[model samples]
Structures are given as C-alpha cells and as structure tokens.
Target: MSASRYQDLVAKVDAKAKEFHERYAAQLQCKKGCSSCCQPGLTVFSVERLAIREWLNERPDLIEKLKAQPGNPKACSFLDDEGACQIYPVRPIICRTQGLPLSFKVNERTERDVCPLNFEKDDVLALPTDGVLNLDLLNTLLVLVDQVEGGSEAGQRFALNVDEVTRT
Candidate 1:
C-alpha cells in the first residue's frame, strides 16, 4: 500500500482543519499537550496504518523513544507521557480532525459534534455550516484511498487500532 494518495487527502484535511482552527481559535481549547480526545480503540485506514508504519521506519530514533516510554493502556499508544503524540507529523486523518466541528449522518439523521472543551461559549448549531467538516465525506475519501492502496487484501485493513501498530 502506498501513502501518496493518502498524503494528498491529508493535505486537504489539514487545510480545512487549519481554516477552522484559525476561525475558531477563541472558542477552541485545543493546544499542545492536550490529549483528552486521544483515546484508545481508534483505528485508521490501511493507507493510514501503512503511512504510520513507513514514517516510523524512517525514524529509528522515534521508535526508540516510543519504546523507552511506558505505554498507558487507557490512552492511545502513540501518546507520550506529556500527552503529545509520538507520531504527530504522520498522525491519521481522524486525529488531524479532532477538536474541529464535524458533521456526519447516523440512522438517516445528521449529527454534529465537537470536542466538549470547544464551542462551549457558543452553540454548535449556530456556527456557519461551512465551519464544520463533513466527516462522512472525509471517511468516504479515506476508504477509497485505502482500497486503492491495496488495503482490500485479506486482513490488511484497519482491524487493529494504534496499540497494535506499536506492537507490530
């Protein structure tokens, strides 16, 4: 699986996220070392998993650093003791979008959400529609990218979470 397509998607996501963060800086409490949203059980597309693996492979120092730290079962394995992500530069798309306003459909109903720490001073529904990321669309794009990257192969998909990424 290749990461070129996934990296393209990441670029788009990062642009959108940057715009939202800039526009909502005052309302967002997200900052360095804040990992309330970095929880366990978060899975990535095969493209993303491959990307993480490739990134780590290129950085043996980071691998050693991650190994040196004590992993917390309660938190994401990539999270450091200081709550910073050990693989921040190559983090998955979902991680890139955390703390941003997101909209997705569930049971034929549109659901919107944000990090509770954010938008506390304003109503989520009151924000401009363009201000929120279309999570469904993002996920669809990610899946397509994954499929193109050979993630459709048996057992190579995103069945494992970040913890397994560390182990394997």
Candidate 2:
C-alpha cells in the first residue's frame, strides 16, 4: 500500500474508534487534561510514526517540548501543557483505543482489558460485549496495512520512545 492507502486505512480505523467512544461514553470519564494513560514506554509502528512525524512538522514547539520531557517511562510525547493530546486527531491505534473496555485473544485465550479508572475496578465484565473494542482485530488490520505499504510483516517500530519517531 502507498501512503495514500495507509491514510485511507487510518480513516477507517478512526471511524471505528469514534463509534467505540460514543458507545462507552456513559462509563468513560476520559476528557481533556487526563494524563493517567500518558505514561511512557511503547512500541510504535512505522506507519503511525510517519503520520505523527508529518503532523509534528508543522508544530516545532511540540517537538521541542516532547524532547524535553522524560522519555524513560514510555509516555506519549504529543501531550500539551494541560496533559491533553495536541495531536489527538491523528493519534496511533493504541492511543485511540485506550481508556475503553476492550478484549482480545491472546495465545488462544480471551483477555479483557479496561482502564483502571473507568468501570469501577474489575467491573469490565459488566460492559456489554458490543461496547468493547476488539483490539486483536484492529491490531491485525494495522499490521496488514503496514505490510501492504512495503514494511516488514512484523511491522517496523521504534521501541520505547515516541520522540525517536520525530527525529529527522
């Protein structure tokens, strides 16, 4: 897939994420200035990195701010002074999917994941099945998009630092 194709896939993924957000709005209190999920340390794919880098090109201050922040913990670098995502519109699949009651198959077993703050401590089971995002499917789709764009089957990634992606 080309960059244009990648952008198309991102659009679809974002649409699905928006639906999930709407479906779970009753349980989710994740609004602006919420930094609970911003802690660092992550594996970001090449496609997502490129998208973010492109967005960052127009925001040099965000680049410098991210560079100055602590990077060892793997927190997102795109957060603004208020702890809200400055590039929320183009955040990666992971960032987009966070703070929701979601589930996936992990090594032949179904694992349900949810934000600690939401759902009142291990009440993830209470959320209707349809409300949770199937990250397993979404992630597989992302990997496929990466491969079609001439990236590795496993996907290209920069481990542990988001600022690394912004480097020229």
Candidate 3:
C-alpha cells in the first residue's frame, strides 16, 4: 500500500513539472535532444528501482532495446545515442526535476539552481515559491516513502549499479 504513495508523489511532481514546462516553455531550454544533465553513474533509491523494473516488465521491448544498445559511457546508460531517455515515463524524481528551477540547501544556506541553459540571467530566487521546486522537501518525502516501502534497509536502500535494471 505504501508503495502506491510513491506513485502518488511521482504523479504530483510530474504534474507540477508539466505545468511549469508549459507555462515557461520559452524560458526552458530543455528539449528532447538536450541531455547535459543525464550524467553517467547515476543511482536511484530502491523504491525508484522497483518502479523502473515494474515499468519495464510491462514493456519488454524497451528492455530489449536497452540491452541491445552499447550504452554511452559519457552519459546515462538509459539514454539513447540521440540523448533521449529510454525510460522517460518512469524516470527518477531527480531526472524529472532536471532543467527546472530548484531550491535546495547547502551548508544550511538556501540556494537557487536551474539548468545553465535554462532561464539564463533570470533570477530564479525572485520567482514565487510556487515557481520553483523545493528539492529538499521533495527529497525528504521520497526518503519517507522509501522507508515505508522497506527500502530503508542498509543494503536495499539504493542500487549501486543502475545497469542492474536491464539484467532482470
């Protein structure tokens, strides 16, 4: 039952992201081919990995396509050569929030962040609270949801190798 909460959270975030992307379409430089943020060696929490596995199980073709590709070493393994995500629908929260204005804390100080290519020279801090995604809050909620799903266990917390998703 708690596992479903994760989906709810994802739904909320996805809606917010979609709305923001639409309202600020001109400000956002994020396009389908843009993948500067899709760095290699990214790891997801166990709950997120479970979501990915479940999503792939429903679409074995994507799994086979992922397996056939000689993954890019410089970018995420799930990214195709053209820089599109193979698992966009079930991408991690971090991936979903990418290229958006995000507020997070660093050393107890609040900082504003956005993709360098996006909203250039515009002060993200000045944007209303609703305009920016509260990353800290989002992360906390995800951790709590993960805990409820039994993902807080020492070894089950995170998948060290994201590639493991393709094997099964």
Candidate 4:
C-alpha cells in the first residue's frame, strides 16, 4: 500500500494499542528488553512488506547492519544489539498486538489466548476479556486498505518471508 495510507492505518492501530496498554498495564509485561515473542521465519502479506520498506528508509544504519548480518530464521531481524525493536513504531499488526489477550475459534468453541508472561495474577483474571484486539478484523481491514491503496490483492497469501525483507 501507499506510505501515507499505511501510516493512517498504523496510527489507528497504535491508538488502540495505547488503549490496551492503559487498560492492562500491570498485567502486560512486554517491555523493551522482553523479546520472547520476537521470532524469525514469520510470514507476512505484501502490505507489511511495504510498511517495513518505509520504516527501513529512515534507518539506513540499521539497514547496513542487516546487510552485514543476514536475517536468521530463528531470530527476529529487526531486533537491535540491545534486544529492542528497531522498527517498533512501525512494526506490523502482529508485533503490535503480541502480548494482549487474544481470542480465537477452536473446535467450534471460542478460546482465549493469553501470553504466558501476562495475566497470571488473580486480579488480572477479572479484567474484561473483550478488550483484546480482534486480529481477524484487523487483518481484514489491513487487506482492504492495502487493496484500496494499490497493494497486492492476494487473499490470505502470505508470500513475504521475514528473512527476505530484512535484507533489501
């Protein structure tokens, strides 16, 4: 998708993220040093590639670092020397919603997914479950916006590998 359109969508997602953090600050311990969810071999749609390309444009030094060290399939390419995300502000939707309470369908029943690091406290268990970001809806919106902005209109075709994106 076009950079401007992607930025708008990112802004909306970020706003929701901010709200989620505010609502569950104590329970969610996903801090900068925490890279447990940062794994490699992740696949993304074309729109995410476009967004990451935009993010890479500003961090030329990081690009050089990535060039010197090819992305490892077992580790996230965007992680810095300090284990912090190099493109945190412009990270993809999956990255943005990492530790939040996510719900999904399983065996014809609704199942809730929570990070093992989070919501362990009894007080947090009473927290509203509805506040978690709806990934299915978010992905649909991403594809819709991407198609509207001249991005690849492929349906559920996650063709872009994270390793390839880290290089060029």
* 65-149 per-residue lDDT for model 2 (tens digits): 7778664344466676678877786677787777877899979998888778777644786667787778888888788877766
When sorted by TM-score, best at the front, the candidate numbers are: 1, 3, 2, 4
The numbered model that scores best in lDDT is 3
What TM value does model 3 have? 0.87
lDDT per residue for candidate 4 within 43-106, as digits (tens), equals 6656677677666767788777766765666668777667788777667777888888776666
Model 3 score (lDDT): 0.81
Estimate the Cα RMSD of every predicted model relative to the unseen true structure: 2.4, 3.0, 2.5, 3.0
Model 4: which ten-residue window has the lowest total lDDT?
Answer: 153-162
Number of the top-ranking candidate, with TM-score as the measure: 1
Clashing residue pairs found in predicted model 3 = none
lDDT of all predictions, in order shown?
Answer: 0.80, 0.71, 0.81, 0.70
* Model 2 weakest lDDT span, ten residues long: 153-162
Q: Tell me which residue pairs clash in candidate 4.
A: none
What TM-score does candidate 2 get on C-alpha atoms? Answer: 0.81
Q: Looking at candidate 1, what is the lDDT of residue 119?
A: 92
* Models ranked on lDDT: 3, 1, 2, 4
The digit string of per-residue lDDT tens for model 3 on 113-149 reads 9999999868888989889999999989988877776
